[model samples]
Target: MELTSGIRDFALTPDELSGFHARGYYGPFKVYEVDEMRRAWRGERLRLMDREYAVYRSEAAESGNTNIANYDRHLDSAYLADHITQRRITDRVTSVLGPDVLCWRTEFFPKYPGDEGTDWHQADTFANASGTPQILWPDGAEEFGGTITVWTAFTEANEETGCLQFIPGTHQSMFYDETKRMHYDPSSINRKEKDGVRRGFFGYDYRQLQKDPDWTPDESQAVSMVMRPGEAVMFWSTLMHASLPHAGNVPEARMGFAARYVPTSVRVYPDTEEIEEYGGRVSLERHGSVLVSGEEKYSHNRLVDRTTRGHRFVSN
Candidate 1:
């Protein structure tokens, strides 16, 4: 397959990088070709809306407010895989995490109108579930196990339609306690409630954390990330971010896709033999790792590859 330069020229500038470092995340960087992305979006939406493709809808309030509907290798149809693997994205990651990199996973998010927004949370707390070790950088270290998350907007992202919001600089901390999964309660406010602000599924109880002498929100500041169709924002895995609720009056839903990249050196699982979920303990090795980059190592275990088979794994 022929490869293009990807979106390097459109990469985040120095000021943009500074903002991201100071804040935790940044951008609306134009990644995919706009016209091409629009075509892909229209085709995918038609397939879903017309029942030509199967979609999994989240059970009410079980897995947070957001309902994620996905269609995979459809990315191949848009040549997204080739573009993503290009030097631009990979090189930038190398600059941060060093030479060895491999894409870990990818998924599409189709947020229907009136769909609930995701609660604010850091990605690292969930890293354990992926079988990847928690990465910590040593003092004065120039690089770490950099995981780049590329979130591409298949449609215009706006506050009215549940755009992403991020809390600046919240990623450089330790994992939030995962001893118990909190029940979803829309009315509950995080005790460190900045001016009574209502943010979604921040795993831990902020009220309790506020009392801990070492805990802080990590220089918190909330800002909505708006992007036009085809643009994307890439952020580190541990960044504190969440999406706003879709309040738009559009007839169709908002769609976005997130592709996660990680270096090959990171050991996926360290101590755990298996993880228990949905009344069963599943082996992470059996599921294997998701290939979002490199020489197209496809897997039936992944949502992207499964889409090619016309089957989806939905929780019973």
Candidate 2:
């Protein structure tokens, strides 16, 4: 859809498109009303507890489960299945990544009260903690590569509840090397502090992946992203981003659902049958990317027409 074609109501404006390219991030636009989100989440949260159709079936998939288990709930839940293809998200995403796009991955990022903030970092090949590239871009776009991540605030995401932070325009160049290895120790959760801020990358320290051992992110340049219950933000996965620690004065937690997208040309996961991360390992037996929009001309990875629990994916 060309910028002037008036293709979709939500199609980004020329200025917004250019701004996204310049900043590597987009708005916290409304995807659902606040009252509606509250009601939907109340029921959906309970429904998610029973994961009979969740893609990752390992015993590791638990409520507080961190890594692989937290990955791809959209592949099972009817609400999430329809959520991914919602035009409110897809229209803007398609404007950035042509019409032929694939929803390769989705995950839950939750920060309960007293939880540590995420360390400042960027992901290129997304191999920082996994020891293998999760998403591989085509050779042509190799130098400047990363997936488009649309993170929706499922619940209130504020500074006190651990809102997101980004160093604008830091997506083009990675500050951390993904090829570097970071050891995972389950005991490390909420036990470490970096530069005075309580933070941990799941079971591993994200600082271990930094390209410079002595260098630290200039925190003075950071900007916090406070979003409402139903708002969403689109950003490049490679952006220098992190989150504030949940200060813990309240009972409610911050829940952000991230949906990752890439052009069909990209390979989802090459030569990897299982993922080992966050102190657990899970097989990719039921893993498949959903084509949320346009045609899939490339057969580089597996594609599923609908969700496993019989939730039909909304294809645009």
TM value for model 1: 0.63
1-316, model 2: which lDDT tens digit per residue? 1112235679799999999998999998999999999899999989988878887878776554657777988888889889998889989998998888888889989899999988787877777777899888888876658889999998999989999999998887877888889988879889988889898778887878877888888788888899999999999988889999999988998999999999888888888898778877788877888888778777677877644575333322
- Model 1 residue runs over 4 Å out of place are 1-19, 45-80, 86-88, 125-146, 183-220, 269-316
The number of clashing residue pairs in each candidate reads 5, 0
Model 1, span 232-258: residue lDDT tens:
777886776777767648766778877
Q: Pick the candidate with the highest TM-score.
A: 2
Question: What C-alpha lDDT values do all the predictions have?
Answer: 0.52, 0.84
lDDT of 2 at 107: 91
Query: Against the true structure, whose lDDT is highest?
Result: 2
